[model samples]
Target: MAIPTPGQPVRGSRSGAPIMALFDLLGRRWGMGILWHLSQGPCSFRELQQRCETISPTILNRRLKELREALFIERCDKGYCLTPLGSDLQKLLVPLGAFSRTWAEVLPHEEASS
Candidate 1:
């Protein structure tokens, strides 16, 4: 799949609003997980795979390529690290993380349907 671009149609928006495009990219499997982990520090492919426990190598490679193309991450000698833009995004998400914790506390837990 091609990386979601601002002007091109994304998953939910036909007009492809920038925010929608961002959501489309980050909503993919392991997309947000990769960025969140990389925010901690640089990690090589093997290290990142370990951090993201269940992510298959194929999906990790694809997400890395897409993130790099989007200027959110870059490969350095150390390994894959977040770019300034990605760091900025991570900062923005911090508050959302806090809110999620609180929200989780309030929400009723769902039992498994089985």
Candidate 2:
């Protein structure tokens, strides 16, 4: 979770934060990657790190903190899992991720491989 400063809210209602706030909160360095990895299932911090291809401890920690405060995730005995809102977000992202993958497959990188 983001380190909530005194006199500042950790997060506000969806209407309260702007689109940029949502993007800025989750699109920060390694932020989406953390969420994407966790989307599969809850995993320990170390497991999450490994799944994220060894994102630096500092950045991973920061993203986790931000995600927590945003109410997009929760920590459990198993590890971190998406909140109800977050699961909704994940559902939304699935198509985006599919598009990204298919788009990339059409790029020169794939052409070069084949």
Candidate 3:
């Protein structure tokens, strides 16, 4: 499948914001997880499947197709790895991971509500 063009509608947004389109794509199940695992390095299908222990082949193939369409990943002789654009994206995710760790630490201390 081809990546949705900028003017095309996606998920809940017809506004055609590029960011919204990206979120719509990445919001799919295991989307971010797949990217996270790929960040470690290129991986064969079996290796990636092992990393994402719970994902089914059907979903993994589907996500790979979509991500390729979006130019975020590619299959090489060794296996699948991030494209340069995707590597840049991985860099951006580093700060988000830091924030997530901070949030997780604070979550345990936050007051519970009835």
Candidate 4:
């Protein structure tokens, strides 16, 4: 799928609202994970693959390309790193991360419930 662009059709939104487009991109498999990992520091392709242990090279390459096109990441001498816009987005997600941890603590595990 092409990178979700604002004003273009995206999942769930015919108008492709900016936020919906963002959600479409980040909601993709391993998309948010890649960004989260890169928030720590830059990583080479191999290193990123190692970080996302189950991600196929093809998918990783695709995600990297998509992220680059979105201007959320850039290829630098060191490796792939978050762009300024990406950093801002990451900061915004920090609260969501905290909320998820708290929610996880309260939610019953499926295995245990079973």
Candidate 5:
């Protein structure tokens, strides 16, 4: 079966916004984890499974298919790795990781006061 791609209809929004399509895909179970691990370097399916511990083979397979269809990653002799587009995505996510650390530190205090 063909995998879904951005610019197509997606859940939670009918506008067909590219961002919504992206979010819908990434928000799936272990989707982000797959990207994060691939950001470092190429990895075989087994290696990916080890890095993303607790992910069942079924879900991992599904996410890989989705990522490939999105042009975010590709499979090569070395293993599965990010495409140039995916590497660019990793660059974009770097700042978010920094922000997350800051948010993480502040969130506990805010929650305690609530």
Candidate 6:
């Protein structure tokens, strides 16, 4: 794949706002975790918080609301779940997970003395 030349924009992107916009939205607090949690199935906010394990309720609520507005997530009888686009985003996270596992495996760790 060719890298975008310096000072030149990539195809179809004007100033990279579109891509940055997605990250700006999702890079906030629980945004990515919310997407990850919803991948299993629809769930309520409480459950979502539990799964994330670290997100504060306030932050989680904010991210979920933002995602819902972006049409990446939805709320229903199930409480919260990914919208169709959100489902697609879930598929995208798979490779990142694999990369993380591979990276952890190659890193050095402390040895326990016998």
Clashes of each: 0, 2, 0, 0, 0, 0
What clash pairs does model 6 have? none
Put down candidate 2 lDDT per residue, 3-83, tens digits, no spaces: 433234335433444654676576577877777888999889898989998699898877887788878899999888889
Better of 4 and 6 by TM-score: 4
Model 4 quality (TM-score): 0.91
Give the top-scoring candidate (TM-score). Answer: 4
Instruction: Give a tens-digit lDDT track for model 5, residues 1-114.
Output: 334455667775576677878788888988788999888789899999999989999999999999998899999887899999988887887888899999999885655564
lDDT of 4 at 48: 86
Question: Candidate 3, TM-score vs. the true structure?
Answer: 0.87
TM-score of candidate 6 to 2 decimals: 0.79
TM-score versus the correct structure, for each prediction? 0.91, 0.77, 0.87, 0.91, 0.85, 0.79
The order by descending TM-score is 4, 1, 3, 5, 6, 2
Which is the winner by lDDT between candidate 1 and candidate 4?
1
Local accuracy of candidate 1 as per-residue lDDT tens digits, 47-112: 999999999999999999999999999999888999999999888878888999999989997779
Query: In terms of lDDT, which candidate is strongest?
Result: 1
Model 1: lDDT of residue 88? 91
Q: Which parts of model 2 have CA positions greater than 4 angstroms off?
A: 1-17, 110-114
lDDT of 4 by residue, 31-87 (tens): 899988889899888998898889999999999999899999999887899999989
Report the C-alpha lDDT of model 6 over 1-114, residue by residue, as the tens digit.
Answer: 133322335444556456655665666666787898789888888988889988899878777767777788888898988888989988998899999999888988656957
